[model samples]
Target: MKILIVENEIYLAQSIASKLSHFGFVCEMIPSVGEAMQMEAADIILLSANIPGQDFYPLIEKFKDSIVILMIPYVNEEMVMRPLKAGISDYIVKPFMIDELICKIEHYTAFRQLQKEIAFYRDYFCNSLLMPTYSINTKISFPLIIKSVSQKVIDMCVVNYAIHKKLAINFISLYKNHHYKEIFKSVSKTQLTYIIGFETLRKEEKEECVKALKNIPVIFACLGGDLHDFKNVFEINVKEMTHGFQEDVLSVDEYIKTMILKFEDKYPDTELSKRLGMSRKSLWEKRKKYGITKKK
Candidate 1:
């Protein structure tokens, strides 16, 4: 990482640079804010609070996106808290150990990386959920159950609903999580409680869960079962790519059968067979064996 140390104290600045250089970090030292402003980019900025006549706020603003650590003589509002609002990531007190400073830098680095990754995934899920997979003309209200052959279908429906309503989801997988009552009790009023793996629950557990979810913005997913007790229960069977479960491993034959059944009319036999790594004759034979009739 590239570090820009802005300090008027020449000896201290050189010492910090020398120590950090041992750790494979590229370090640059600027004596004044005027000199620091001439530079374009850096991964981190270590700005000294005691730069007599120089205003360090401009330097902080320039590298606001980078990790800016304020090096202060003492902890006070003027040196620490006030600069934080102006985009200082953290403050390290003068006379601190080098190890402590390195720890702060590493912590902020990991935190910033996590923030970027979260942002990327949020954008990805948001865009992917907006895809028009299954359309329902009837206006479906919340606090319902979706019974589907695969969990993927239920997830799509729930995510689409949450996105449409501009509400966040407090998702809990009942198969993996047993302390669901606590989660349901703690869920925010603004968020929806989306629970999956209803098939894994016992009869009494189901009754208790249903009671707990009453009159709340909730969506329950029951995979490969009939859950008709709910008032707004939707049983959806997608024939094209319907598997018993989302994570079920399909055999070679089963995979071929599913592909042919789903895409036989979409592509010609030659192209489809080539895509599936088989000859047209072999594709026809497999279709016949699987009892899948092709459309005219």
Candidate 2:
């Protein structure tokens, strides 16, 4: 990382540069803010706040994106607070330990990196949810429950709804073993919360979850089953099929019944039986047992 040190004290600047160079930092020393501004870009700016005749605010504005650490002679609001409020990263009192200065630099560096990463991910998540095909019903209000056969469909709907409303979503998946009681206790009343895998909870647990989330602003997406007893919650059942296969694993009988019913019109009985790895007679017997009939 490149560091620009703006200090009139030549010896102090050289000492700082020499020590930082040992740690693999590219250091450039300038006597004034004017000279510092004339230099190339730097990852960090170590600006002396007590420069006799130089105005430091211009330098701060120039390197606003860079990590700016003030080197102040004394701790006072006049020398420190104004720059800090103007977006200076941090300040160190003069004659401080080199280790302490390095520690501060590392902390702010990591913090700036974290901020960038958070911004990138926030934009990515929002852009991913902004789909033109998915439509959100704005008439429906919050504290809603969505019932769907497919979890993917529910996810798409909720995400699209959040984007439509221009509200940020705090997503919690019950499948991840999150405690419902804790989730309820910590739920944000300001932001919109989306709770997925509601059907994964037991019937008694569902009742408890419903009770806990009663007053919270949440959108519950139940992958299967219905929360019929939950009062004052708006329920939406989406019947549309998403682009992928169902997430829920089906029993052999259920799988066979669904496949036969779906493909009976598309393919003949012989082909369908062959695809299912069964004889026509066995397929017929299975269909009769499952009470599934081919529509004429």
| Model 1 residue 79 distance off true place after TM-score fit, in angstroms | 1.7
Candidate 1 stretches greater than 4 Å from native: 21-24, 125-296
Candidate 2, residue 195: the lDDT equals 84
TM-score for predicted model 1 compared with the true structure: 0.56
User: Which lDDT tens digits does candidate 2 get at residues 1-296?
Assistant: 99999999999999999999998999999999888888768999999988898899988989999999999999988988899988899999998889999999999999999999868765654564323334555455446777655445556667667767788889876656446566775469888898876655666877877666665678887644446776544433332332343344456765676576557768898999999999999899976664443455
lDDT of 1: 0.76
TM-score of each: 0.56, 0.57
* Candidate lDDT (C-alpha), each: 0.76, 0.75
Error of 2 at 152 (Å): 8.1
Query: TM-score of model 2 relative to the true fold?
Result: 0.57
lDDT of 2 at 163: 68
Model 1 C-alpha lDDT per residue in residues 61-99, reported as the tens digit of each score: 888899999999998878877899999999999977889
**Can you list the residue pairs that collide in candidate 2?**
none
